[model samples]
Target: MDFRWWRRSFFGAFLSWVFFFLRFSCSDKACAAPEYTFVKEATSAPPVIFYDYIIIGGGTAGCPLAATLSHGGATVLVLERGGSPYTNPNITNIGNFASVLLDRSPTSPAQPFTSEDGVYNARARILGGGSAVNAGFYTRASTHYIKKVGWNQKMVKQAYEWVEQVVAFQPPLMEWESAFRDGLLEVGVLPNNGFTYDHLYGTKIGGTIFDKEGHRHTAADLLQYANPRKITVYLHAIVHKILFRHIPGTARPQAYGVIYKDAYGVRHLAYLKRNSKNEIILTAGAIGSPQLLMLSGIGPGYHLRTHGIQVVVNQPLVGQGMADNPMNVLLIPSPLPVEVSLVQVVGITKFNTFIEGASGLSFVYPLARRLAKRFRLFLNQSDYEPFKVPPEDMARAVDTVNAVVNRTLRAGIILEKITGPASTGHLELRNLNPDDTPFVTFNYFKEPEDLRKCIEGMRTVISVVNSKAFSKFRYKNMPIEALINLMLTLPINNRPRHATAAISLEQFCIDTVMSIWHYHGGCQVGRVVDKEYRVLGVDSLRVVDGSTFYRTPGTNPQATVMMLGRYVGKRILQERYLSRRSKHKN
Candidate 1:
């Protein structure tokens, strides 16, 4: 009762034990609790709990579907394996979007894109999914692809409108797009009809420079429309399995609930509980969508059997028909040193100070897209040969680039072209477990056309850069010494150049150049899901992300994915999952 030493020592020791107990104490049974009973709360009896719909993967398509369906007053639970988007700073910053590609760590382990064989491709893994962490580039699909995907004008146009509203897309401001235009013009590649390239179906192609706020807009901004009570977006909930139950007598089965793990590593089951009544939609993008289905026994028989996973349905197309737009950037030494960081092409530079916040290179999409469209239309009308590029298309592309260069003083260029052949890829289950990353094989250049076009495009880039106009920019003498060193290190270009004492463009491409991080394709048409995006053999499950593309678009896939999400959401809403649930009330 008397000592100051006793008070300090005994009380401090007691508090330490309390802190340790609170931090680490937990029942082994609770930590390893199975799917059910984890969330059990005792009422007068076992409380009846049910959800009208359960959606796994709160990614690009999943978020929208969850929002749209939840608005109907039915209980909707969105299970995302990643953490809450609120904590991620990089998720909202447009500049950091591209940097996410460079991060291949475990917290955001790089998802398999290209095969372990040749190409390099990177993907994002967070709550907002890829949208939470992707470059803010947006482009709608070409008219040909839209029609091929089995969408009529009415449906496609409607989807476009939905995308525009959500992303707040607009033509680049004149000042913003002007630098890009100037750059093309300086090189004499400007198109005659102006730069905004709108297609036959009104879909446009061009880069997004400045956003509507006069600030840059990202997909995180668009997907965040699910706010307050409308949508319950849960993060750090990785879906382990999609619970399915077959019709009592029939062979067909329907998905009803999802079993997932929470942040605390506690597993919980949001069971449908109703027999053949609830709907489960798999909007988990191309890669994840197919992988999840296979985990649940819904992919190619041989592959599933080989992986030791029982095949619920031998849907051969489950992970086939993958396609991605092969991206290549042509680089040239600029006469003037760019003070801005060029490590990766991004951000609002001082050049943006000219008009409407900042307008030069950022706002040129409208002008550029218009020109690309006219050229595309002209090519389609003529007898187009892949290997033999028509003189007309070449001249047109050259003119477009020249016009843009001259307009923007920012020289030393890299023409990014999506002209390569669209090769298919696949994602097979590497393991029977859902949590494991699957083996993805892009098989990028499977077709001869893909190889030829890529080679041709590289040659075309060389021909233009080595021309008379660029040679005068003090660049003739400065022949990318760094690139030469790279070529020497790698045997990608072993053959002799066209001339001696000078490196040719073809050599640079074959050696130093590599694929842009734009890998796409895999869960494409005829392979992954049907025309409506419904998995061919499964009921109520679908894929609606870049993975759903059969042939990669000639440009970026953001706008196309947005359009698909809207299209699927409308179809689901029109069909009304609520009405189906009402029927099960009895």
Candidate 2:
């Protein structure tokens, strides 16, 4: 195997998309950036610095939060475990979607981990977080979801618009996406509600972060709204632990500073300014937030003691209620060429399920061949449905132009995922190492209600595949059992799945479950944090990302997650400023 050939074959199409990102001047409004001077490499920070706020994780929520907190001249320090998204071609180019997700490198933007449930999943390791790596579909939370979360309705709308102006776009539907939309409606999925950003139940095209030119505009672009002079973002700065101490009159421990290590492995301390109501906020997504809390001795007392971590607060709920939307997909291996696209058209159903799709992702096969060998997993395509092998199969198909390379085995995927998975799990520390992924189990389909939704959603998918619009792609009746075995990678108890009808579709739903990358909770609002997102047992500490949500917002959570940052940032400004004025009068 020529490693050089693999490198060329892999990056050939990706390098072609470089022209779309060559000129990066934030001055152009279409580019969705500003003359931002705030970002600096983590190594550039001093040994110690006191600031108004120390935000951990420069991700989907962290970026906007930092930008909004910069208003009225307050300083913000954002510590990110990953590198900047600005210069990384993998983060900027849509063509590299599958490749980035398939990348198993220690520093890849999409960090891969296998859960305790034996399911493979990826989490963001870039400044833009999941937005830098996801399907880029943008939809607001349902009006009811917003109200249920107890957010100020007007402020939520205002925050969403602020983010939309910079990142979200009315994506142009390509041939594949256009047909996918028609297929949804033809199957009676909905009332054909055209293009809209609201979370309406029906077939419609939603906003995307990818522009007409196909370059991705991630949540990092939201930083253009930040006052550059007041914010400093440190990339590759992994916070080792949150520093806490008992205040003289406070009821519980107060977070005052954090100890982080730069890429060079040198430790640095960032703290809040004295007595002015400053705080340390954790916007480190669902996984990272709870992991950080446990590492900082703020989790369950017994668990912390096993690792020799002296308990600060015995918060038993630090890593509880972890949930991820279970995605089940069927592939259409097409002989004809299809345009490469992400999630543009979605079929929101009344059964608490969402049907979405992607096309022309043929680039992942050869790469999958390599990944299969690397992970020591058998690449038996005989049972596989098509291009993107299931996560359980240890391979992810990248969406490269198959026609460019004269490949005929192109493919598209029509995936259905349940919204409120209802079944949840917990997160636990594998070790004290912040660099290592913590143990998380989503316990897919553990609840009977989740399985019921899967059956209903699968039935809807069958209808969509049988629609007249999709007839041309259906080469033959591919066995559901093969898709289950190929996707779930479940070993037989001396029983070959394809040889016999040992598995039913209902059992397949339970066996073939995979993550849609919408995993959230663990540090949920009422359990771990207050309505204001402040940590319940600690002062000057807050958790402000998806981990706070009891359920994901709408069809996707990126838009709402980003909005939460701006919304919360605005609230902090209002409350903190009043406190500052009151203290001055004294």
Candidate 3:
């Protein structure tokens, strides 16, 4: 029998099959890779663009939502006011954390502005939004928050996983972060939660978007999820207004399109498809969303009319309840160089305060020096009292002081933030012009309870620094009391020494408090949008960013913002499918 010939034939056939499999597998890999087609200028775009979903502000929320919707075969358009994050080193590099915020260019991802209270604040303008410029700390919303917000718990978990797969990273604990973690525990921050992506009580180390090599993975990275052929992204596309149409007898106004400008100052219009379940979503952060709504005639009726904007919905709460987490820093100047890190370890206290630590080379020295000069002016005369010196000036002073300490000494700065400030502020129209920044007032320390909590947070910082864990690195000359006294100088006016000192400390906080950039609550649920995230008085429009948060969660808001973005995307897809099925049945 010819058994050898049979075996040889089988082996030949097996080899041919293997080669065929290899060839097709390589081809499949090439096909699966995303090929993005971005529009860099508005002038290059078609005269008018149409999409099933148009998202304004290609930010943390907008990017993910666009990616999700586009992946589901929906034609999506993303309008971003700033340049692409891919080319911005300040946004892509973890070491440029301070530099991004320090940049004052008109196109910088972080757009710096002064609030009415004179506090210096910044809003993200880049495609990745706050995720591109923030400190990169990442953590999920509390289970309590998920329940309160009426989100599907199972779907929320999936959403977190979907985001984490691409952007979240486990930060390696360096020496400084390790010491900070120990100090937090020694001071009774207690029950170390360890490395996790979940929000937990006491001292815990959460996920970061910065990887091991010091590269940042922003929400812009999530754009990889997009089916590029179905999505169109326009950078430097500044949305000026959401065009609305009111039916003759209907009580609600319909948003049909958006008008925006390109970098070349050329205007363009993007409209939703007619006679379809198309929608326009606003993910323009806490400040920009409300400001845009007011511009579109959706804010307070009289306020819009004052600026010559025709009334549309007359939603008085559009920009009414703005709030930001107030933060203060205590610089611990170390003689030795400290390891560089971001918000790797956080101490969650019972008083609604969060203590975060960072140690690295100071990046904003020049800006800090300028702020220091302003602080000197603030201290010079009685006319320049705490409230008199505008919040922006005071914010500059506080930031300058922190920067100076960081630059002058090779040291670590222990920053304490009041996560849940009792006093809330508001945003108002500076003018009717869409290009002008909105007038913001944080009204920090307006509530006695907020002030007391801040004081306690400051004390906690001192205690952590004085703990045995930090004894090896603590500067001997910097006595806690002396440092506090130096930083909190005030005019003594015929009062007892104790009263004078107490008053001075309080004034120091009022003058130096700044927004940690955790701003939220403008187009909040029960106010501007409903639980489904739809604008109350507008059809085919939704708000899905930090602006829609009912209240600021206990930790950094970036993770939660991403989660909600994913959650809303899923809901939109579900609703679209249901609508299709209903139509088919009819």
What lDDT score goes with residue 235 in model 1?
Answer: 63
Clashes of each: 58, 1, 6
Candidate 2's TM-score reads 0.87
Worst-scoring 10-residue span by lDDT in model 2? 15-24
Q: Over the stretch 179-220, how does candidate 2's per-residue lDDT look in tens digits? A: 778889998888998999999889998988877666788888
Candidate 3 wrongly placed segments (more than 4 Å):
1-35, 363-408, 485-505
Off-target runs (Cα >4 Å) in candidate 1 are 1-49, 84-86, 95-99, 109-114, 169-220, 223-230, 273-277, 339-415, 433-436, 463-474, 479-517, 577-586
Please estimate how well model 1 matches the true structure, expressed as its whole-model Cα lDDT. 0.48
Spell out the clash pairs found in candidate 2: 98-398
**Each prediction's Cα lDDT score?**
0.48, 0.77, 0.73
TM per prediction = 0.68, 0.87, 0.85
Residue 218 CA error for candidate 2 (Å)? 1.2
Which candidate achieves the best lDDT against the true structure? 2
Which candidate tops TM-score? Answer: 2
What order do you get sorting by lDDT, best first? 2, 3, 1
